[model samples]
Target chain A: MEIVKKVVIAGHFGVGKTSLVSRFVHQKFSDQYLTTIGVKIDKKVIELEGATVKMMLWDIAGESSAMKIPKKYLAGAHGLFYVFDLSREETYRNLDTDLFELNKSLNGNPAIVLGNKSDLVEETFIEKLHSSIATDFKITSAKSGENVEEAFLQLAKEML
Target chain B: MNLNEIKFRPLEKKTQVIVFDQKGKVLETDNTLVEVNPEGVNIFEDTILCGMEEQFLSLKKGEQVELDCIHTDFFGKESHYDFVVMRLEEENPSYGLVIYDFGAQYNQLFDLQQERNMAQIQSHRLERENKELVDEKTTIERLYNEMKDDSSSSQYILVKADSLLYNLDFKEILYLEAYGDYIKVHTENKVYVTHNTMKRVEEILPANRFFRVHRSFIVQLSKIENIEQMSLLIRGKDKVIPIGKSYKSILLQKMDQL
Candidate 1:
């Protein structure tokens, strides 16, 4: 049987959460920054072994505080992607607190942490940032489309 | 203790301590308290040790345990916490607790549950709509098939010509002629003229037995004596009917050998 899963893409403003979603869904990227207003929903179906998974992705507008995120938009989410911009120190700096706040708001769902815009940063710096954070994170560049598919697939696998 | 002060502390140092009675009532707490309440309500809600009062009372003297629970605030923000509980012998409270906040993890699971429900609703709606369309298409196809069977069985028909009616076997008719607003059906024994256009004449005739070879003629396939290059000769009629270029392929298609 085919199962439908709802996944949420969330992060701080300009952290490339929308960029990561666009790259994964449409396989295209733009350098221009188009801020998401409230939420944008897109659908994609992944073929699994003997079953198909239709994922309804909710790309919510970025915010520093989890409380500012509209709770309704996050409703019915199966999994979550917490993305941060690697080029910006502040984005990674607030990762722990933001994730804590998100955890409280979401009641602790399964989530994948992503460090986006990897193409703009040095690997050593990214590695250092990765080690400092307590969770396993995937470094990605939405513009370069690196590790975007793997991150989603990992979430999907965990969900299954 | 002021938990808000510890909220800003470094991640490594952010720790919470709570002392509760065997009944799971909050007696005292350290900097880990999420909400400040002088009312001192019970920490245990639906889970924890709320329903298992007997289990808490019958625990061994040095028993230690870990448990998780959800705490909802006035603003409706729910925080999840994991606690390690140890039976306290010297302290005023019977239980000493060390708490670890895991509210984010709980939030993620709740969101997943909500999303699954929404997806199931959408899938069900689409399935219902699809079933309705299939039912409608099947009903239309069944009616068409029944009508086709009825037409094929009707090999004879009554031809109304003016005030008189002529009973003619469709097989005996050679061809039809379009004359103004009337159609002259030519048979070997006699001619029957009716007040109807050739278009209407073609509609009533069974499609398998009649072939409209030209704009002014519809010939019975079995009554054809011979087929020439662009014309056909009727079995007993002296005149040959010309075939229209547009309908020439259709006539040839009907004459194709098995």
Candidate 2:
């Protein structure tokens, strides 16, 4: 039987969450900025050694510390992706608070921390962040297809 | 009728009767009555009548009391019954308890309630399914538009400019230019700005009729007036589009030579 797992993709506004999902799912990228309303769902199947894992990806709208994340969107979610923009410092500053709220709502599920928009950021700053953050964080460029697949595979493995 | 004239009267085999003395003691009972209290004042499923016990015992001579109650029979079957208690005479008054069978009406009420509950559940289910159908329609429509954009045989293309959809023929397009987050479609009489990438524009435009002359421009092959070393002029327009050095040979190879 194929195991189906729900993964929620969440981040702040303009943080490249949609771009990352588009790159991974469609292998396409667009420069135009489209704001997501409510939530969008996509599906992908991963082949492991003895199992095929079907991931139902829920791309929710952007949430800040002030905005309340709708609880219905997080219902029955097995994992999460908390993305931030590498070029914007404000998206990084609210990472801890957003993760806290997500954890509280999901009762502490596993999550992947992704710093996107790496194509527009300085290499030195990204390298420094890799050392400061204790968890497994990936720096990705959704625009150039950099480390996008690796981050998804890593999350899928962790969920397994 | 006389106070003692109201003796035991026979009822249907399944019907239940309980005769109460002036002080509310059970004087007699039907053969179907089971599980009577040891004191015989109240019987099985009498819980519904507990509140009216005071009024039952205080009934005066020649007075009557009538009410409806839900009751369970000796076989533990339940039904609604019209209950009437009457005091026959003033001398040595006694109360007669007569229960009218309402099993058919009670069953009809139960059936109606079941039907109403089913209707409510069905209504909620239909609402949820309708929303799903609408969502499916939207997805199909978006996919259809994308498929049309990907088609190479079509002579017309649907373009969105300023949030409005326009179905323009391929010949009307002079050339497409890439802006930051928008594409400017320069036509014969006007320029329309739309949110799209140049890569997407290339996919939508027919490859045989259009050529990617530069990173920022896709020009119609039929509309090219003349090609300079660094720039090319399009018909019916004064603007010159720069040709990329990498695309120079491809542009030349695409031309029908003598």
Candidate 3:
């Protein structure tokens, strides 16, 4: 028996949280301003662990100030996809808060730290931050389509 | 790190002279007589040899006798000393008794004071060192906790297979390996490669769990099956990772401790 899982994408404002999943499921990129108000959902049926798992991914807005997510949208999430911007320190610092709050909302939910905007930051700076946190993180440029799917795939692989 | 043998030395036999102040309490005990020129009995005489002889002659082995001991000044003043105190009857009392009082025994007081000071200094140094060892132990414990947490917690590494999230424990990861732009994460089960550099990928993995073996490879030390010279053999992959020159010594020392 196989049960479908819900994976939520969460982070600070304008960190391309929505674009990461949209890019993964739709395989498209656009310079568009679609601020996710409450929650937006995407469905991707993929072959995982010798079974067909339909992953209902929730792309939560990446606004740091919007700390509380209403219960209506915060339903039954099994995993988390945390995003952060490389150029913005505020976004990175808020990443902890995002993970913290997301964990509070969905108790014991697994997460993947996604490092967005890898195209701009140098490899040296990224290497320096490598050993900081315990969670796994990956560099992906949403605009460049760089390891975007790998970041999402790691989220599903480690959880399922 | 500079260790100069910390061995203990045995006490040596010595000839002693006990000096007392006006109060009759023994002030200074010196081994000058017992150590050298035992035949010279008069140490406070007109000549240096006589003065040495006088110090020895002033005391008799079994006689509890006090004589008029002369104390002199460096400027050649013939100061008459009242004291030579000896226990003519007792056999080796814990301390030789003061049977006589001589010229001001101020120099005797000064010498004993210096010895006391040296013992205190040695004790103070040991106290500080003990405190530092306690501090070092605390630091080691803190680091150990950090390492344990990193290994046990779930790490979200980017990968090509979406389902790898459930299969691997982040702590089981030994290292990240780089092959050009594609970084392969070699864990217990299988090796997964994604479009990433080891440097960039290292940031995503726990620093303590996955060490950067080379620019092309990062290996989990816990999972290393064997080390053949400069190469490390990971379980799954036929290809071996090289042990870098800079990291070789530290790796060897740590492996030995394990």
Candidate 4:
């Protein structure tokens, strides 16, 4: 039997990767912010082109604590969601380094980008930084849950 | 540990030496399409490779014999390293002494590598099988726990604060709202009011996961989906579970801990 598909969400700390998952799973919002330790795994059933894919989402630690990158978390993974807190320009600037590290770890694995907190933003920063990362990956928001489903849908298309 | 850390050696060339084995050994050179590798051959008297030992298996149980062997050679001009190869089994008449053909020798070497890879693959399969067996018990226990927590199948009997019942499946009872000398036991279909204190019900139900959200209310943790300050939105309707000031800290901790 084949294993379930796993998509990993990775980005700088407080980029709201966990919040994105909460928005989709719980359909509710928690304004209280808390740091994620190590990893947080969540599941969602997504109906792709023709299959009901059980997406096992692995939200990786985003803290800048000089912690070692976990390799086993990346293994058996089929897609990557690289997130950025668009409300903060510095977080957006750090996207290049994040993409570089992801490429090195994944060995050229496919990815999609997320610019969270779009409700707080004036414009889509993903477009401005489009040239630095693969155009297919960049997307905007979390507060409004805008473009969230599209991100994973694009991933399903590439992986499937 | 990272799989990338596991090093894979690239193929290179090498030279080999040959040796002979003598003793009262039963060596047979059979030609029954035996699968073997030349590089792994073992020489008799501990002088040849383990591969060559198979030839002895072909030999009689107690016959003494001379083994044939060739010096290990490299594949390319830039290749380095060497080996000593030998065989004890009688040469097959169908393919006699083609050992002199350098290309043939390399083909034998390739066969040897393939055999080694096959052996490694077999070992990996066994290790995975063993790990699966070892994890079976833990996996079952986890699944059983998940099932038990969600079943909430026990029949609950709500009683007065003046009395507590020993038999209760607190899971089936959705919630309890206290009124006067009677506390209501709200099961799936009907609500039965009993003269009991919310504290008494809280003592019997699972705490940490369960909560006493309101002054006169006790709610199952899993049943609450949303909390707006003091009010909790319980599952199944627009109803809310009120949170007492004293219970606020514990409820907040529960919300953040997960």
Best by lDDT: 2
Write candidate 4's Cα lDDT for A1-160 as tens digits.
Answer: 2224667788766678888888876666676555454456666777776677766677775633212446645555678887777655545565666676766655566787777877775555545655554534555566677877777778767877
Model 4 residue A108 CA deviation in Å: 3.5
Better of 1 and 3 by lDDT: 1
- For model 2, what share of native contacts is present? 0.00
Candidate 3, which CAPRI tier?
incorrect
Cα error of candidate 4 at position B62, Å: 39
Candidate 3 residue-wise lDDT, A1-160, digit = tens: 3446778777765667877777888888776645554345556777777876667776764455436654433445678777887766656765566677777766776777788878778999888767775555888888789998777776677667
Clashing pairs in 2: none
The weakest ten consecutive residues by lDDT in model 3 chain B span: B1-10
* CAPRI level of candidate 1: incorrect
Q: Give me the chain B TM-score of candidate 1.
A: 0.56
What DockQ does each listed candidate score? 0.02, 0.01, 0.00, 0.01
Tell me the tens digit of each residue's lDDT in model 3 across B1-258: 000110121312221344332223333444332222324332222121111222333445444333332232211333323323343322332123222222245346435544554454346547757877999999999999876686557665446644454345666665676767686666666667667676677676665556666656777777777888788887665767898888777677656554
Per-residue C-alpha lDDT of model 2 across residues B14-37, encoded as one tens digit per residue: 455666665556666553544445
Write down the worst ten-residue block by lDDT for model 1 chain B: B69-78
- Quote the lDDT for B197 in model 1: 89
The local distance difference test score of each candidate is: 0.71, 0.72, 0.58, 0.56
Docking quality class, candidate 4: incorrect
TM-score per candidate, chains pooled: 0.41, 0.38, 0.36, 0.36
